[model samples]
Target: MTVPASTAPPQDEVSPDALQAATTPQSPARRRGADTRALTQVLFGQLKELEPGTPEHSRVRAALIEANLPLVRYAAARFRSRNEPMEDVVQVGTIGLI
Candidate 1:
């Protein structure tokens, strides 16, 4: 999510007045979903370029899993009333995600 310094707008070039906008704030869940989608797209693109079983491919695959962990947790929360351990639920959900 880090923007490179070279791509940053210069401080003097930014207008404070232009920064004001009337917009509804997005909920954290919505924002996170959007971010996850974008990250997954980028990572998948990278994954396609990498040869399977290479270190880079493995790293990107791991990143994809990590980035989507929130989704697994969210799904796992639905089963909370079932009396199963939360960690176990998440683990099973993660396995499905993988």
Candidate 2:
């Protein structure tokens, strides 16, 4: 999962929210058994050349983008089961990525 940058403590200070976050119990089953390989291929296929990349290689960016999507699907699926509408779920997930 992506950590929120704003929550990270600076070199000499800490925050209550960050401390509470550390103690939070995360879900073990990330999703109802997602097909990570398939998801990665799908995400990678959907991406364009986005940029020349830091060193002109596409694989690095593709991997980075792919790595985050299964979690997106998982969060989306959970919202879906919790009564969120399908279109809304996808929109929320997209917003999460942004």
Give the number of the best model, judged by TM-score.
1
TM-score of 1: 0.71
Alpha-carbon RMSD, candidate 2: 14.3
Please, what are the lDDT tens digits per residue for candidate 2 over residues 1-98? 88798987767577989988878865665442355556656656545444555453466555655577667776787775566687788777867764
Those runs of model 2 whose alpha carbons end farther than 4 Å from true positions after fitting are 1-59, 81-83
Clashing pairs in 1: none
- Over 4 Å off in model 1, which ranges? 1-22
Indicate the worst ten consecutive residues by lDDT in candidate 1: 14-23
Worst 10 residues of 2 by lDDT: 28-37
The residue pairs that clash in candidate 2, if any, are none
TM-score of each: 0.71, 0.34
